[model samples]
Target: MNDFTFLLPTKFVFGRGVTDRVGAELAAAGYRHALVIYGQGSVIRTGTLDRVLATLDAEGIEHTELGGVRPNPEVGLVREGVALARECGADLVLAVGGGSVIDTAKAVAVGVPYEGDVWDLFAKRAKIVAEGKLPVTCVLTIPAAGSESSASCVISNDELKLKRGLSSELHRPVVAFMDPELAFTLPAYQIAAGVTDMIAHIMERYFSSVGPVPVTDNIACGIIHALVEEAPRALADPRDYDAQANIMWASTLAHNDIAGVGRNAVAGGRAGGWECHGLEHELSAHHTGITHGAGLAVVFPAWMRYVWRSAPERFLSFGRSVFGIEPVDAEADGVDVTPEEAVADAVTATIDELQAFFVSMGMPRTLGELGVTADDIPALLETLEQNKGAVFGDLQPLTMDDARAIYESCL
Candidate 1:
């Protein structure tokens, strides 16, 4: 256990019909004008848009519509939303899709206050002012990426061909209304990608530290278990509300640090590296063919293989406790079998399983197969280096060489 402090001020209204509360909550929160951000018309087809707008109409909140936010959100779109907010006199920024929507709103919120280009935020040149970024909330349709309640947003630039994040306590949403029913409208590939991305959040946090936090470890393990179990169920029937609810809660809990709390927790402090995200971001930036989550499935386990030796015990714990993988490798190595081997094998198997899951759900499996090439790796590496530090949060303290090697290895 380590010294830690938890801060989650946003009200989470969960469950099937819980989103109906958003209209009254927005009024209570003093949001009069809103920028309703969403992707294409999927929300409209699902009737979610009508229900949400009706709620807002009842509450008398005026809003401007900003749609067409792409996956891996763009900085230009953020700017567009900022302009919309300014023009509409919108006090609230309402994100109505999945991770991309929420993240885009976050970028717009932060960018509105900064006089310079929003790219500065990605470059680590801007300090977030809590009051600066437009106040934002979400009607979450996807359970992946945990962006709804977090202060993290991944944004992209077309000229740079780069995707990076802007995070601050100031970026956290004021409230998040989750409706599992909306998720039913998502395609199978989208569902798979969301699940993979959500689990990566936990894996990154779980593998960072070398110390002990039994409770936190258990909670991380529990989230993984929930994901592994519910993923198949949800894919089989998108209408499985219980399965959807479990995964929805797991995704939120994983990133919110609700589980990883202890006196000596490794914390996302600076150790939890998002190498998987870097790889996936580059892939998504270059080719719209691969979803962020599928790329993560390929890259994350490879990362584990590269770095597992740093803290084998952590692997062992993850394997035995989380996935029930047996340590067969160490025994074959002429040493006493260890949980580390089991963990590593478990991760490899799970990543492969996830990739296969993607293929089954109509997604690409490999970098080369997706039309991503060795040529693209160089540009992707360039985009990844835009971070202030080598790695996203230092789980492995990525360097240019290390990042290059990871991309090359993924090939």
Candidate 2:
């Protein structure tokens, strides 16, 4: 195991009616003014926004509202939020939706106290200090991206056609109110995509170049297995509280650095293990219509096919333990297959199993299905270079050529 330090300071309040406690928590924390952030109109349509507003009003807490945060949240909205929060003299930022909303709130929290432009933080020109950020809390209505308890926040610059993620301990929400009931109305596509996104979170950390970190690996595998089992149940009945609860908690654990502990993600000065996220960020950055999880669904399997040769042992172990694949023995089974062939078969089977699961969840299987073609690959590569540079990943560092081939293979 590598040397690492892990810290998760967010107080996660999870249960059936925990959304009702948002106002009381803030009141107890002595936050008098808040900037409430949310997405388009889901919360409003479902009456969740009204309930939250009522609680804040009843608690005598003043609040300003900012809405219309789209998927792959934009820096423009974040800028607006910062201005609004500053104008209202908000000491707290309350996000009332899922990852995008929470991420925008996080960006606003850091941006409100900064002297420079907020995009500079995403661009790595500025650094975020914990003391400079406002307190942030959330009512999670979605289970993907894990921004509620995560140290990372992603925002897209519409004018520049770039999407960037900034990670700082200051980005973690001070509190997360996760009520599974809030997710009961989500569309099937959203549920599946959310599940895929959480799975990818663990896979990125689980596939590391650093030697054995048995504890983190076990945690990662267990979360993935639970998600794999519960995702279908959630899809079949969105009101399945147990399934939603498991998935919500799993998403939190997936990206909050718990599964990534003891791993050097910055090895070689590259964002080593999160290879597919780098690729999908380019896809969603170029085409705003694509969801983050949907893009991952298409890119992850193709990436596995491209890189499995570099670390067959990782794939084989994942196959047997996670998917319950039986160990292959040449002599015991009286088979003619060589050891290399057996390993190859297991790895291929693992990849196939993952692809089949995505397909079962109604995820697109190819870039073509997402309306991305050979013509789009050049622009994708351009942004990929801008965001991720010439190389990324530590398990099998990928050059620009490798990325292009992976893109082509997906199509």
Candidate 3:
């Protein structure tokens, strides 16, 4: 294993009706006023909003409400949230929806204390230098993105057709309430998309070009196996609290820097290659209608197909560990098949199995199926190049031409 540091300070309260403690927790933490951020009418319609409001009222905590945070989240809404948080003098920013809402709240938390434009932080024009930020917390209603306990937050700019993410310890939530029951009412498609996103999170770290960090690899593989085992059960019955709990916790563990701790540094300084995420972000950023996880479902396997040749051993390990696909014997089941050929076959089968899993979850298998075409490639590439330079990924640094080829292969 490589040298690494792990510091996760988020106080996670998980179980049924754990959200009921949000008010008392905030009050005990001495947060006098909070800005409650949420997405559409789901929170309100499901009565989650009312429950939260009543809790706050009981604890005598003042709060301001900000709704309409869209999926993939927008910089405009984040700015508006920051403004409202400042106007209300909110000491805490409480997100009451999924990843989008939590990410927005994190952005707002950072923006509320900084004097410059919030976009400057994400665009790399400025840094978060404040010693203190508005404390952010969440009541997770969706189990994707793992933003509730992660340092990273992704926000989109509609005008720029760009989605960008920034990671800073300041953005990590101070508290996160996870109640699987909250996700029981989620649609099957959303659950599947969340599952795919969480799996991609682990895969991104697992495919790192770093040394053989057996511990990290095993943990990543175990998380993938657990998700593979539990996602279907949760999808079949959203009320299956055990399955939902497993997936929910796996989502958090996948992206909380735990899986990629020792694997962040490779010889090329590429760290955990997020090539697929870089590509998928552009797709979602430009299209706006494409779900983040659904786009990932389409892009990740295509990315694997395009780049697996660069790191066959890593791919083979993934095949054997995550998918439980053992390599064929060199001479047993076939006529003069080399060990290399056997490994290659195993890797191909693993990728095919992953694609099939995504399909079984009702995810599109191609960019075309996700509503992207050859004509969209130029625009997508332009966005990617403009936002993230010419190349992406650490496992195999992908240049513009490489990205084009990956998109073409997907088509």
Candidate 4:
């Protein structure tokens, strides 16, 4: 068993219209001026931003709008926001959208204290360990990236197709205002992608060395159950509040370090192994890109096929418990499904179902479908190949060969 320790301090405020409480939460944090950070035009189209601004104004909070945070948020933007916050004397940050918004906000908060370019944090995070950051709060719109509660942010340096997560104990949001109703209008594909992301979170942690920690196992199982159970209901009817709430909580809980907490647990707890993340980051860097959720859809199954040999009974247990695919039947003298195949099939089925769900929801299902060409592949692979040797041993150790094979299979 690998040894470990854990600490998660993000305060979660959840419910329908719970986002309206951002003003109160920030007041409790003693912040008077803040910067409103969020993603593209959708937040405006949906009026989530308008409502958030109205609520903040009602609470008498002064703020500046730093709009135009993009998908695969750039380090340059984070640095720009830091400059904005400094010029305006903004003391706190309110991230009013999905994972990218929160991730971008976290990057800005950290950048405020740094003297150099923020890209330093993403490319080589060894410098500033932690400094005084403007406390951040989230009005999460997308549930896919658990970044609302996670302390890590994957920033892409636009000049290069390079992407890496800048992590520090300093980056977790002080508050995550997760209102399920806010997620009601989310497109069907986003809903599928969000649930897919949560399932990946659980699976990444579940593969930890099969220890006898009942709590960890139970938590992993519960997250898987909540995700698999609510995905269809949410997909069938986008505005189901109960299904939305169940999933919203599942997505947050998936990465809050509660599910896979135990000393020497199989999956790395303090820092979970993100084998698929390495593959998906480059996939997103290429083309208009697949949703992080959809990239995960391909990366995960292809990855399970790559790692099944490392842990057989664990994968078998996953198939049986999560997918309800039993390895053997009492009446069948016939050959039973092997754990490896069952787990792989279950994972692939999960991905394919998610892909079908993605198509139904107006999201891309394949890299080719996303317009990522063969020209993009070589540059993308080289981005991670150069870095894998440097960032080993979080969830699993990955060799360059392992990285290449996974990418080729994903293609």
Candidate 5:
């Protein structure tokens, strides 16, 4: 266990019909005008946009709309949104779609009040102080990324082929409305991808290089188990409210820093390394069409295999606790094996099971499956090496050579 302070101020309005109260929630929060941001035609086609607009109209709240926030939301669109917010004199930024939409809204919220370009914030050239940012809120239509309740926003720049993330308490949503019913129409692929993203968030925290924090570990394992169990059910039957609700809430809890609290070093570093996410960011940044979750699926297991030897005990613990894989007894399989061999076997089985689960969910198991080739590896490694410097990960420091090995293994 470690010393920590936690604060989750996002007003989470969950359950059925909670989205209809978005207007009232904003009104009570003193936001009179909102710049509503959304993605392509789905919200409009489903009448979700109309419903939200009607609620705003009933509440006499004025608004402006910014549509067309794509999968890997671009910096140009975020700039346009900030301009629209300023033009409309919007007091709040409300996102009505998925993570991309919400992230765009958060960027706009910060950009609206800042004099400099918003890219500076993502580029780490400027700090996002709380004094100037507008409040952000969301009506989540997708359960991935957990951007609805998170303090982070990721934005991409197409010209540079870069995807960067910025984290600040100012980016956290003031309120989030989650209606699992809204997710019923998602395609099977998106559902699976979303669940994978949520699971990755927990795994990133679960594999931290910190002292034993039993409570946090238990919570992380429980969340992963819940998602692993419920995701397939939701995919098989999108209208399965129980499964949908469990996944939806788990997504929020995974990234809201709740599962990570008290597990980090007291000196302030994440227990688990985000090396996989750092690597996957390069993939998605170069190939904007690649799904974030799919890229993660391809990279995470490979990263695990490359690093597990450095922290075999941790992997053994994860295997036994999360996957229920019992360690092999010495000489149990008609072969004499040391205790170390037994632990390694359990860890290998757990990683295999994880990769199998990703495959079962229709995720790509290799970079080749994701359209990456031998030629692409160099550029990807360059991007990662530049951004991450010489090494990545805390559980086991991964230098450029280690990263190259991981990418090669993924291929």
Candidate 6:
């Protein structure tokens, strides 16, 4: 295991009716003014927005709101949020929706104190200081992206045709109210895509080249197993509280840097990076209409197909642990195969089964389903190169050619 430090400062108020605690938490923290941010109209439609606002009013906390945060959140709205928060003299950033909303709130929170444009942070031209960012809180209506507790925020710039992410410990929310019931009204497609995104978050850490960090590996696999098992239940019955609750908690744990600790080589630890996410970001960046999680569902299997050879043992272990695939199952009687070949067979079956799961959840396996054609591959690669550079991912250190091959395989 690589050396690591795990710090999760997000205080999660989870379970039924936890949404009511949003105001109390804010009051206790001495936040008098909030800049509420939400996506489209789901929260309002569900009366969740009214409930949250009522709580704030009961506590006498002043507030202003910015609505219309869409999936693959845009930076323009974030700039508006920063401006509105500044205009309202807001002291806290409160997001009342899912990942995209929370991500936008985080961007706005950091942007409020910075003099430069917020995209500059995503562009790596400016660094986020923990003390410089306003406190952020959440009323999570979705169980994916884990932005509530994660130090990461992803924002898209439509004009630049770029989708970029910025990570800082400061980006983590101060508090998150997770009531599974809040997600009951979500469409089946959003639920499936959310599950896929949460699972991919774990996989990004699980596939690292770190080590025999069996404890962390076990944690990652357990979350993946829980997500895989519970996602279907939630999809079948969105009102299934247990299933939704499991998925909701799993999403928070997946990206809070707990399962990822000692896996990523931050501060010169080891070899492992977010390879699939890097590739998927370009896909979503090019086609803004594509959902981030759906794009990931299309990209992850192809990435596994391309890079499993680079870390056969990791894939084999992942298959065995996450999918319960046995090496013996890959062996044929009277067929003397090399160990590498045996592992490869098991890994291939594992990847195929995973892709099958995505399909079963109504996810598109090909880029064409996402409206991405072979003609778009060049632009995708160019943006990928611009964002990720000539090489990325410590697992394999992928090049433009490798990325092109992965995109082609998705086709």
Task: Please tell me which model should have the higher lDDT, number 3 or number 4.
Answer: 3
Instruction: List candidate 4 segments past 4 Å from native.
Output: 1-3, 209-212, 263-271, 329-366, 373-375, 390-396
Name the weakest run of 10 consecutive residues (lDDT summed) in model 5: 264-273
**Deviation from native of the Cα of residue 294 in model 1, angstroms:** 1.2
- Count of clashing residue pairs in every prediction: 9, 1, 0, 4, 3, 0
Question: All candidates' lDDT scores?
Answer: 0.75, 0.89, 0.89, 0.74, 0.87, 0.89
Cα lDDT tens digits for candidate 3, 303-330? 9988888899889888888888978886
lDDT of 1 at 381: 69
Which segments of candidate 3 are over 4 A away from where they belong?
Answer: 266-271
Give the TM-score comparing model 5 with the true structure, all chains together. Answer: 0.97
lDDT of 5 by residue, 232-253 (tens): 9998999999899998999899
Model 5, runs deviating above 4 Å: 266-270, 331-335
- Quote the positional error of residue 224 for candidate 2 in Å: 0.5
- What's the C-alpha lDDT at position 372 in model 4? 66
Clashing pairs in 1: 1-263, 1-264, 2-263, 2-264, 2-265, 3-263, 109-133, 109-134, 316-339
After best superposition, candidate 1 residue 344: deviation in angstroms?
A: 7.5
32-150, model 6: which lDDT tens digit per residue?
99999999998998999999999999999998989999988999999999889888999999999999999999999999888999899999999887665789999999888999999
Query: Per-residue lDDT tens digits of candidate 4, residues 186-216?
Result: 8887888888878777767776554445667
Which is the winner by lDDT between candidate 1 and candidate 2? 2
Model 1 per-residue lDDT tens digits across residues 139-227: 99988889888757888787777777765777779899987877776787788878887778877767765476787788888887778
Error of 5 at 361 (Å): 1.0
TM-score of each: 0.89, 0.97, 0.97, 0.89, 0.97, 0.97
